[model samples]
Target: MINDNVFNGTFQNLSQKNMPFEQVFLNILQFMEKDPTGNFKLMFGTDSQVYSRETKFITGIVIQQERKGVWACFRKVILPRKMENLHERISYETTLTEEVVSLFTEDKKEQLIQIVLPNIYKGASLTIEGHIDIGSGERNKTRIFVKEMISRMNSIGLKAKIKPDSFVASCYANRFTK
Candidate 1:
């Protein structure tokens, strides 16, 4: 069985503290309700860092209304020992992101989608994306695993994004993984 404690652990942003997963879901709904006419994107991503003794992983969940604003939060998971393998670390990050995404059940996603359906004619819509930290750049050590990671995200029905464009992972979650 999945551990509820880990999945429902506190998520925090600059303005919110120790919020349970349910509160985070409510906040996202409220944000969308405030401006249903705006285009929305719900994004999930993860980044990790290997310290001397352990590996720190930060998974970020963001809800963005195009050109307006965003509501985001992150949760951290740390492994007892450092994960030194490039492929293993990248794979673990993806797994963490997927675990969090699984918490947004079909019903929850439908609720978020329903909020924007009425505004669809006005060019408003909602899209879900999974951002993987790996990239295809020649010099990027994570290049080789991009396809595999993207495939993993796609398997769960998320539009997959990577590197430069995946700010949620390469930028946001990355900040806390340090």
Candidate 2:
């Protein structure tokens, strides 16, 4: 965690080294404020992968402004030990997502809403998509836990995405897990 209660985690970009969360958040706010078109959507998600001795978790913040551009920031953590089973792994991943979300205080959330809401009424769009790594398949044991995961996010008022739709976790975060 960034601090006891804040997720001050740092992230990196192709041309940049690690950046503090405060700066990254500021960058997002500036991006919104400078957006003359006011057409942007913000998304957040977490994903994890396991190795023999540890599990790596990554969380991302994405901003999409159609016909303009898109930008993303991410942070990662490594747990020293792996969980016992797929169920445990999936559960732990959810906990990591919750931790990242909790890092956003009520004030920050209000700030984001205030900046993004007006765009919606102006013919723009806003979406908050939570991407989980679990998928439904004949061999996928994690399928059983999908509903619970979705419900967990719903309790916090965020919609959840999985598999193909959950590229933030399944694709973006998966890249850094290695």
Candidate 3:
């Protein structure tokens, strides 16, 4: 079980509200790298109308292999509305969780992370194949299955790809003792 206090939790909003563009973007990246094997929460910002695509992106759908590795399948939808302010940049962030993948505790988290991280994209086509209630509470939980905010967009009818350069531990360093 997660000790609860060790981790600094952040709020994930899924309402019709406005959020800091850079902050929200980092949140998605942190979320992905932390649980690479495959899990996510629907953190909503203002509608695509209010914000630009540069300020928004999605964590990949983490696919799981019954007895193998994990990765990410990331996605992005760049609309014309996005401002030129961030047009020079076109990459999604992904975090890698350190714990190894194993059984129920193993397969779903890291395995899922691996499958999805590698697949995230800004110009990809998506299809909301179905709906699932993953039970990740309002604050996002490591023990909880991923919670998705359904959306299926396309880049000329194809799913774009955000390839991983390498797996990063994503957080701070190793010297601190508990």
Question: Clash number for every model?
Answer: 0, 1, 36
Worst 10 residues of 3 by lDDT: 169-178
The lDDT of model 1 is 0.91
Per-residue CA lDDT of candidate 2, range 1-178, in tens? Answer: 3333223357765555579767777777788777634676666677777788877778777777777877787887777777568777787677777766776788887787777677766765555667788887768778999999988877766778888687878887788777
For each candidate, the alpha-carbon lDDT, in order, equals 0.91, 0.74, 0.26
Error of 2 at 135 (Å): 1.4
Q: Against the correct fold, how does model 2 do in TM-score?
A: 0.85
In terms of lDDT, the best-performing candidate is 1
| Model 3 lDDT per residue over 1-178, tens place | 3223422222223341234333444444455555444434321111111153333322223322223333323223233344333212111111101011111143433443453556555321112111121223465331132211212112112121211111111111011100
User: Model 1: per-residue lDDT, tens digit, 1-178?
Assistant: 2355434477888788888899999999999999998999999999999999978889999999999999999988878678999999899899999989999999999999899998999998999999999999999999999889999999999999997899999999999988
Query: Candidate 1 or 3, higher lDDT?
Result: 1
- Candidate 1, run of 10 with poorest lDDT: 1-10
Error of 2 at 118 (Å): 3.7
TM for every model, in the order presented, reads 0.94, 0.85, 0.21
Quick one: ranking by lDDT, best first? 1, 2, 3
Indicate whether candidate 1 or candidate 2 has the larger TM-score.
1
- The TM-score that candidate 3 achieves is 0.21
